[model samples]
Target: MITSAGPEEGKSTTAANLAVVFAQQEKRVLLVDADLRKPTVHYTFNLANNLGLTTVLTKQRTLKESLRHTGIEDLSVLTSGPIPPNPAELIGSKAMKQFLQEAKEQFDIVIFDTPPTLAVTDAQILANLCEGILLVMYSAKSGIDEVNKAKELLLKANGKLLGAVLNHKKAQKEDYYYYGG
Candidate 1:
């Protein structure tokens, strides 16, 4: 799961790019839009928002039925379907765990784009369910205190912190990209 201290930290963008990279390597990748409150994976992939994680969790659709394929081979996406009134409850429910288990078994890599750590408990909840959590922070925009706070929250939730991603870094040389660990 990819999350940050707050919004617009490039969590979704990082998740999407990582999913594509994994898929390009011939690995079966599943980009799950777990950001039920404010989803963007469907928009990023230009896919439908009809059926997805919410649908599966609510028992309205099976995991298989909710998955949509990207034009890139071996890449599938499970967009957040129908914004529900209770996002945190739905994400922390037993059904969400079961859904994640199933997804883990089905894909080589399951990349979840969740909400900010400081914004809600959704990311913390998902961090516990997922194997690891990647913290994304903008270069100049992210405050040190907020980043630390987000890290502390994840630790409290027993979420594995897999290194931080420094995003929106300035360009210096040809190899200098926007984001790096």
Candidate 2:
């Protein structure tokens, strides 16, 4: 699962890129837009959002029936379908656990693009289900206090925090020169 302290911190972009990277290595990847409130995975992959995670979770459609194949070889996407009213409840449902089990059995990597930790409880709820969570933070824009609070929340939920991605860091010329070789 990939999320951030707050919105517009590159969570979705990071999740999508990670999925593509894993898929490029020949791993079967499924990038799920678990951000039910404001889903963007469908937009990112240019797929339809009529049937997706919500549909599968609600038993309105099977997982296989909702997964959309991205033209990017081994990548598939399950967009947040129809933005349910109770995103947090839906995410925390037993059906969600079943969905995760089914997804893990099918894909080599299942990346969930979740909402920001501070914005909603949905991320925290889903965090416990994920094996590892990656918190993406916008370098200058993200406050230390906010990041710390988000970290605390994830830990309290017993989520295994893999690490954090510091996005939009300006590269120093000297730093670039060191790696230019």
TM-scores for all candidates: the values are 0.95, 0.98
> What are the per-residue Cα lDDT tens digits for candidate 2 across 1-181?
9999999999999999999999999999999999999999999988899999999999999999999999999999999999999999999999999999999999999999999999899999988999999999999999999999999999999999999999999987788787765
Task: State which candidate has the highest lDDT.
Answer: 2
How does each model score on lDDT? Answer: 0.94, 0.95
For 1-181, candidate 1 gives per-residue lDDT tens digits of 9999999999999999999999999999999999999999999999989999999999999999999998999999999999999999999999998998898899999999999999999999988888999999999999999999999999899999989999999867766454552
Kindly report which residue pairs in candidate 1 clash with one another: none
List ranges where model 2 is wrong by over 4 Å.
Answer: none
User: On a 0 to 1 TM-score scale, where does candidate 2 land against the true structure?
Assistant: 0.98
lDDT of 1 at 46: 97
Q: What is the C-alpha RMSD of each candidate to the true structure, in Å?
A: 3.1, 0.7
